[model samples]
Target: MTIIRNIFHGFLRAMSSNSKIPIAPVGVRGMRDLDRTKFSLNVILPVLKVREEKLSKISNILKQYFLKLENFKPVQAQDAVTKCVYFNPEKITQWNEFSEKDKSIFQEHNIDHTSFSLQSVQLSYDNFKIDTIFKAVLPENEETVSGFSQIGHIIHLNLREHLHEYRHLIGQVLLDKIKTCKTVVNKSNIIDNTYRNFKMEVVAGTEDYFVTVKENRCNFQFDFSKVYWNPRLGKEHERILSFLNPNDVLFDVFCGVGPFAVPAARRKCTVFANDLNPDSFKWLNHNAKHNKVNMNIFRSYNLDGKDFICDIFQKFVSNICDGTEKLKEGAKIHVTMNLPAMAVEFLKHFNGLLRNKENTVHVEIIAYVYCFAIGDDPASVAKKMVSDNIGRDISTSILDVFNVRNVSPKKEMMRATIRLNDVIFNELQEPPTKKVCV
Candidate 1:
């Protein structure tokens, strides 16, 4: 019985060894990591040699059927020939196809097929596009990783649970494919924390978090793990800055690394930027200095949103109203509350703060409050939230309901620009009676 058991065990071990996952065969051009998880493909295309001077004419004639592979040069030197043009494999499978199916094309173009040698060229994994490589390697019917936000040298991915198993493989592929990406991170946790910075793990490439990003012709460097930076907000930032004129005042309640404040300061706008995150505050100052923003026009603070509004914001407006803070002619006060998740809740503090001083303040006050909502009418939903928090129906004061970006399939990041008119600041006082001409 013992001898029979040993024989069975040995047989089982042999079967297991034979059933081990197979590593993919080596690629033609020495592609790396061609294994069961990472794979490669080989493609062949038709090629023909021509003189360098005729390259432009031939390319123009066959531009529709020319190889469209990105980062690929269809024209190359072939021995004594100065130029060789490759055609799409799908259009011309073999040299005979050009003579048979595509014979009319040559006849129409008045080309001599016998003058040029018809040859087939092979392409390796190195020649394939990033998307093609991903589609070839990833499992069938699986959701491939496509969208990503590039901040500086880091690629941020909010991958779903289904991609968890292939996280490393996906990271490796991205690091290899993207030339500017030095680090790839996956954020698994929700961004509901106090500082709004999500915890992320470095899936591939270097572990460095410090990176410098350029936006709106300004440089900003910060620690990625300690602060929040979204590259997709570039257009929204530009849109907000468009409303500001020289000598305008900006009060950024949730400024992160001075995306709005620094650029506004450079544009000669007096900026008072604040954020609860200490790292963000530190980088805001750094970026301001780096971008050579006028120090006289830029100020940063690390304070709670409510405290900043109560102390800093209230005092600034009070100074403006009391004539203590001098302003240039046509200067306006623009408040930017960019904390989308909970910025609407802070709108209540602005309600009565501007009361009784509306007449004293000469310039207009516009509040750009950002919020996230999910519905068919997300802009209206956001407007209602702002109106409910401020305790006023600001339908007439609504300047613009801009859809900043789509946060999800149904959720949107909406910006409601509300002018601080008599409805909000004056607290519904009687309208001034019109004077009849004597």
Candidate 2:
């Protein structure tokens, strides 16, 4: 009985052993794990070559890697190619390894040898091929590839690591490049040596508002206290200010961070700045005080309402003129709303403000639209104010689409200019004695 039981036990052990699947080796498992989480050195090395054949090899490797990984989606590959490494294929020779020949070629091409760090090398006996990869470290806190600030340059490289780990470093490199290359041609030189150079007062929690460089003995001032204010819009503010007349009553709607309003007021124009953001309103007041600009600024959130124009006009009439005065009686008002996209919708509303029998008012609404050519017609963007306010159609023809800047490799933001004719309301049959600005 004991012999029979031993035989049965042996048979059961054999079946169990046969049923069990073969476990993957540690090296294979490690490679799989690495493949799932990180970019492979094998894939990156070919991209460094910058040749048609090398590019093809890189694409194939990427495809194989994507297939091998359970979850690997290529969000942007072509764009990545343009950004990742800076090398001219025509001048630089293709190198399979960091051999004497490769070093000599690099020297010939003036490629910085110190920047390249060889991370790994693998040999394939079956194919008689060698794989060598290296990483290039950008300058500390620099935001560009190859130390060039061109908008979409790759500054850093990671072999077998997540792309996001080096994104900020890459972005910093790009930003640094932009700052280095950016040249503001001061035609009028308003900010040149003449104006009293004062150290900008540092407001707590507003570091982005001003840039103080002690090396240059210059402090760049930006109106940070108002709505929609960005240091990037400094040129726009200067442009508007340059065109302003001293006695012109400049009205700025959506006056973010007071970029337009502050500059206009500084130019000695009677400026009325209005914004929907409360924080911006506070900043606008603070900036006005900071810049020492004498101006009337209002903070209101309901600028999208249908009755907003009339309400604002009433207040302007009472404050600027006497209480009983009306617009279109004899008022020459230069209306300026930098929110160009929504300016068209406000035209009808502006007409309503000037309709009352108070005074004859001439209103000029400068509409700005940002856009680019789609095919033959330009692709434009404008906020339909009437659609936003009363759910009405305000689809008017685009006057002129002006290209502002390239936002991406294929896309751009442009500004369009539209004009509204002399609008007189039926209620203003008899002009009032006092002229009220709309």
Candidate 3:
């Protein structure tokens, strides 16, 4: 009838001191299914003066027949000369069945031991997924739960229409299950294409709008209620940004909250960032200053992507021609169009981009255009779409095409990286015929 109150802390023989993996306690609650019959009956071992080398041998033997709870420290009286160690033995009454060699070690030191009354506890490795939890709590037909997006501290749920009533329960469960999330919101409206923001109702936690997102070694602060921020594209931004060098030029069209422009500027690349959404522009400026990007190198613009390209391209070409804008040899020049829905169609604006200029800009002008396409092979479809929209033959223009992610079962987001200089600046090529969509 012993109640074990002692906990022990030390690395076991198998554990390393510098392991990065997070260690869970013997029992942790994670909304998991539990079996009532299975539990550990702890055995409290009396402290003994044993050789330092024998600790491993004694621990190994204890682990053979009981649960070896590692990394637990004992709480004892301040003046106590020694502390007790604990183990959870499955068969509490079988302590006398040990071999004679093991019995000598325990009996020789007179280390008294007692068994603890069994207590229910959760296992660390249990099936605690949201799908299972939802299915258990929700009705079968109404359990149409669409997945959620982890945006900053918020769990953004765009649940299927049928699951609206359970949004609060779902949000609370998500908040409880996740360690980092503080707030949860259900999307009230679909994403607004023009502004890229969405209406949301707070289902759990505080009514908060301000959130800071860290990505690509940069921190960005934005009003989540007013601007758009997606945590999923952090890797994609870093991937393309690795191609840039100091003194390179980046024109980020539809640069929502400066995900691309701010990090590029941090790399010492000159950035001209633009977005039609006023909130995005304001946050872009704010984030650039907050991140300590050189204002001389980073400039924010509020204009449509079409206007940003047509007007800014002319100005950059003008500066390149007049020798006002200086760049290092082989410095890359990039035009980033990130509005996946319309960015590909925006390529037509670049057809006659540098044609009429007398500027001999010796820089590689590259276009990183994103789009959404539906097909089995969305990458190929995106490449052909870019070729047709930019009015260039696909054979000579494609530098690379990436299947970004699946938006849905049929729809996919893609990025087509093309060197616009090869096709646009070619004298034999005709000016692009399609109108710009952005």
Top TM-score model: 1
Better of 1 and 3 by TM-score: 1
Off by over 4 Å in 3: 1-132, 141-146, 426-438
- The TM-score measured for candidate 1 stands at 0.84
Cα lDDT for residue 207, candidate 3: 82
Model 1 poorest 10 in a row by lDDT: 21-30
Best by lDDT: 1
Model 1: per-residue lDDT, tens digit, 1-438?
A: 896557546534543454321112233222334343223433334566566666665565557657766557777787665667777655543444454534555545455565444343444545666666656555558777758899899999988886776778778778877899999999989899988899999999999899999888899999999999999999989889999999999999999888999999999999999999999999999999989989988888999999999899888878877889878889999999999999999988877776767557777889898999889999889889988987877677788898999988889999999887454365565568999999
The better-scoring model by lDDT among 1 and 3 is 1
Global lDDT of each model?
A: 0.78, 0.38, 0.71
lDDT of 1 at 187: 94
> What are the per-residue Cα lDDT tens digits for candidate 3 across 295-338?
99888899988898889876786688679987888898898889
lDDT of 1 at 27: 31
- Write the number of the candidate with greater TM-score, choosing between 2 and 3: 3
lDDT of 3: 0.71
Q: Could you estimate the TM-score for every candidate?
A: 0.84, 0.42, 0.71
**Candidate 2 least-lDDT 10 residues:** 125-134
